[model samples]
Target: MGDAPTQQVPGLGDVVGYLDSPTAVCGQRLSVHLSSTVGPTRVRLRALRIGDYQGRGSRLVWQSGAVTARQQHEVEPAGPDRVITERWPVATTIAVDVSWPPGMYLIEIAPLAGGQPSFIPLVVRTSGAHSPYLVVASDLTWLAYNRYGGRSLYFGPGSNHTQSVANRSYVASTDRPVDASGQRTVFKMTLPLVRFLARHGISYDITTDSSLDATPAQLVGQTTVLIDGHSEYWTKRMYDAAVQARDGGTNFAFLGANEIYWQGRIERDARERPTALTVYRQAGLDRLARADPATTTVQWRHAPLLRDPAALVGVGMSVVGVHGAYVVNTAPAWLLAGTNLHKGSVLDLAFGNEVDAQEPPGPHSPANLQVILHGTAMAAGRTKPSLVTAAYYNAPSGAGVFAAGTTYWLCELDSTCPGGPTPRATSGALEQITLNLLRAFAVPRAGRLHPSAATPYESPAWLAKRLPVGGAATGEGQ
Candidate 1:
């Protein structure tokens, strides 16, 4: 399996922390509460701007004098599947100012006492006028899987300290800190994608996950909306805003996979800000909360808001597994452009974690949805093959919707993928294709745009390429 891993060198520092707010607008003041083990130690705060240079990692945006480190938060037993985070007095709330451009910023916190640096993820959002694209961070998913105090929605507190912990926060708050090292995308998807956009000078804005509660309009005037990494947990408003954006002529590029597949509700604080996320992982949860639209929690395709993700993204979540090498299928030139990748091309080991397949072409699923990458997945005991499709479709409003169909899309762009088996050829192909999408989607075209007829469009060849030497199809859509 491919993994995005972190690297460390002597003298160079690394940071491990989370931001109070998942995101902040440019010029807006947001607090960054940093924590460290050593007391009375100076720390340097630097904002590293991600770029495209092969060896050039990032440029420094801002710096700060080292502040004394202290442990202010404590973890304690709360409930079965929760962790209560209590913030104490000792904290240096650094205010992010207007000078910071609207982009992803790596909040590097390095101890002057000589130790590996810690990293806190923060993104400065664009204010007022909309850019070409509105980038969203997968924060809700981050918190959902955060086993900070030893509990997560997946697993409750266990019997021992190593086994489990507990929490009472019925609705977990963003005010609580995330276990930075425990975060998967901060280094894997977020950093690499952000740097890619910056290096290519893509005109874009950014916003956090939960901010969809009060900032659905964040999509206004933007040509494209980009969602990166695992955006599995989504509130109703976030999903609606995306739909509204598509309907309103805003293009979308879901760089991540398994997006908006489940339903979640936002918990508000006294100020009406989203303080927590509530999810029960059952369709019944949404029925119980259907009376109040804000609290509805269920599979998006199940009840109440029975809007299918495949209809919006052109493909819905299906099997969970890996693709040895994503086979290129029928794709428009606007989609393939600079990438030499064409029909019959194989992106070596480019797919993993999870993937989606286009639903049977029908009213709900757009007929225009074209298979960009074709592959298959095996679910352990399943004898039949499940289709893996990276799809693309154009909305009537000239808004293009593309789903990467695999969770590993952005990670493939990460040149630092762990182990010696990095997909060098696959990475380059994905890079140019991403740039092509951004450039093409940013432009307003009359009617919907599709891949040129000059390009070959064949799914059979793709399937044939993926099929084993003498294997035959058990059945279609199996």
Candidate 2:
């Protein structure tokens, strides 16, 4: 919110719009769509690079002169998925050349004739970048929560939209503007981590989930891949690419919880450009499941594809609406160096909203999975309390992976997390832990140099009982 107004207009009835796409490479042209109740409104737009720049929070990159913006009508919802597409004419077009550096950007549109000012977030990616660190924004998740045009994949306008199955869209188009709620998600979830990275002078490349799907090669050869903030939805191509990267010795940091829960795919227009995000909530009943089962948008651990999420992140989602704090259980000297955390020390309100834990009697976790921090929360719609676990593991490929198992990890850095403010001592401890994790993962073949220690459950005595007498007992057989 640097060059843009901090307060957003009340509703979508004011001036609102979105870009033709969420991402762009240098030398590509971007179209900005606009609709306004104030006809012939004088519009002033600017592109601001988003991050913490000495506490200013943003830097102005480009600005556009006054342009005439007119009211554009919205197209009605179509198809069983209730796909909402805005066929608004382009109010302005911006040429993204080498002058604009590659990073996260936002286009601020202000109507001078008295209307609301809106913003369209964009990520400028570079194809040739092979930075030591890469941050992938959860753009797909942002769209999933976007309530623009009166419908989202989850919620709608009235009381009828409150139900999980009724009045929801299976497919949502990117042509519509992101509402105020989606904008708040960016500030609350993603921006704090971005600021922390920038303040630490960590040189990294940033891209969106859709861009990674379009060009998977961008993910290869990176020392570390960091996925931040509530990244619940994933495309098959994106999931496959991440697995391939990990297998090839690229480290990963899942800094947020509830990741890769559901499968989704991108739909394209006749021109072969990505148009809508499609996901069938109840994949078993989907008509497409009869023909192509993989295309169904079921949970990752469900039928047809029984790939459990714990196998990837070392923990599976357990409870939602959790407001507990992380209590240190087994902090390795290497991971928790310089921090005052010890066994049984609690970090105030470090876990909340949603969390993950090791699921027993279900799918198995990765080899040498270590639970460093633990928390407990009352399971949603249930009376029993569930445990939340933050874990780490070293893959056979010599790639290190750590899962935070909570959505509010980064939010603690900038003190923007909901529920309450994190104490200074708690914030410092988490920040140091993050710095240590990032610096370690930035090294090539991190697992080879700093292999994970055996957890209590993976001790020789624990493994001996599960194996044959003469057979060797390795930590890998959990």
Candidate 3:
């Protein structure tokens, strides 16, 4: 309110643009400018509400002035532009700073004196300036016991012997807080990572349970990728959506183990909340045939895609267990840049440490696949093959398709084994390889920066030549 200002601080257009910016980081500061015809007696800044639009309904995420005694809120004055910079404490700022998962959110800014609130529509993204908009599809229908059947890590109260195995493993807990309001734990670990990345700058979207049918066209705004996390079961629409995204220049990261093994259908209630229905079996090949005949199968043995020939020596489909101990492997590669490992060293086990091995190429294998990491036989002896494969196939749209072999291993980047330990030699190598693949197809703004000089391993131009004609090797499941 200085010198007959031409603009008002709480003008509708100003607030609209501030909220409309495509990029906004949580810890970053936002300065709002205002003007007034005459200097008001006094001025103050406060958050009004955080809201969103879903279908035809409006939802409120937060309200203003509803602070607890322990929460703190304050306002600061900016320069003569009559700008009032509102400073919200980190903890209490959740109302203003909070990101609405992967969905759409509508934020409103209102004048304390009761003027109409300005609406800003925002899509919270994950980190990375050019990071792809990652959509995490978690199939909760088939919650594997333990981490891939070793000690029931994802199921319940239990323990593992190996340090690497235990550290990266997720044990089903009766006490651990469940995600999405105690409905599932898979979302719990995954959602936090999503939020963390979004707060840092990465853009992402999420579809869970029955929301899997959100469609590939709906995800058009996304540029780079899609993620399949520990997705044991998937509905037909979900599968189609992933396929469409991949063909449309949207790369993929399979961050879970034994993905696409089972087929699921969505059962929605009146409110549209989804409940997943699924079927599982010891023999994935048979199960796949029963579920979806069009699905392809993976080749666990003697396949050009596998990176390490030793790991698949005995294990397949399911893993019995894994030891999380560091071993010597390629370190100068780009993926290991920031990692402290040099030569023979140890790192944390990422996932599927000890698992029930099943036949190689267990089920639903895609064409033009590549194997990045191969699981080595542990002391328990590698019995069956646990194949972690990646493939590039030609979709109906004429674009190539890239599909991962194993899902769980990809998620191990920040996870620990169930034994409260470190990764063994072979598993550690797998973790590094997984990181490389994700980074390659991630947002693609810049290659991952390493503190020290690192060599880039570019994808081979003749990859198409290496792939089998007509598609992947058929009927070679182990």
> Which one is best on lDDT?
2
Residue-wise lDDT of candidate 1 within 1-478, one digit each (tens)? Answer: 1111233211123333455566666555555665555444567766765554454666677777767656555557455435455454434565667667677666677777677776656767667656677778777777676555545555555676445433223345555555532255565556667767766776667777877657888776667778886788787778788888788888878886788877777777676756667776654533457567544676788766678888788778866654445778775677788788778787776665576776764567777777788676565566666666787877777778888887767767755432224478888888888888887877553126653221223333355445431122221110
lDDT scores of the candidates, listed in order = 0.64, 0.76, 0.34
TM accuracy, model 2: 0.91
Candidate 3 whole-model C-alpha lDDT, 0 to 1: 0.34
1-478 per-residue lDDT for model 2 (tens digits): 3653322222343577788888888998999888886666788888888776777777888889997778888787788778899899998898898888888887888776655567888888866656788889888887877778778877655655256447778887888898865665565566667778887888788888888887888778888998886788888888889988888999999988899998887887675567878777787556787788876788888877677878878888876666766778787888899997898787877776667875553446765788888766553465546667788888889999999988878877766676557788888998999999987887867888777764543322332243221211111100
Tell me the spans in candidate 1 whose CA falls farther than 4 Å from its real position: 1-18, 38-42, 79-81, 159-170, 180-182, 283-290, 417-420, 445-447, 451-478
Per-candidate TM equals 0.84, 0.91, 0.44
Q: Name model 2 segments beyond 4 Å from true.
A: 4-13, 113-116, 160-164, 361-363, 454-478
lDDT of 2: 0.76
Which sections of candidate 3 miss by over 4 Å?
Answer: 1-131, 137-139, 142-184, 187-189, 195-200, 214-216, 219-221, 270-350, 353-368, 378-412, 415-417, 423-439, 442-478
Candidate 3's TM-score: 0.44
Error of 3 at 78 (Å): 64
Residue 475, candidate 2: Cα error in Å is 41
User: How many residue pairs clash in model 1?
Assistant: 16
Candidates 1 and 2 compared: the better one by lDDT is 2
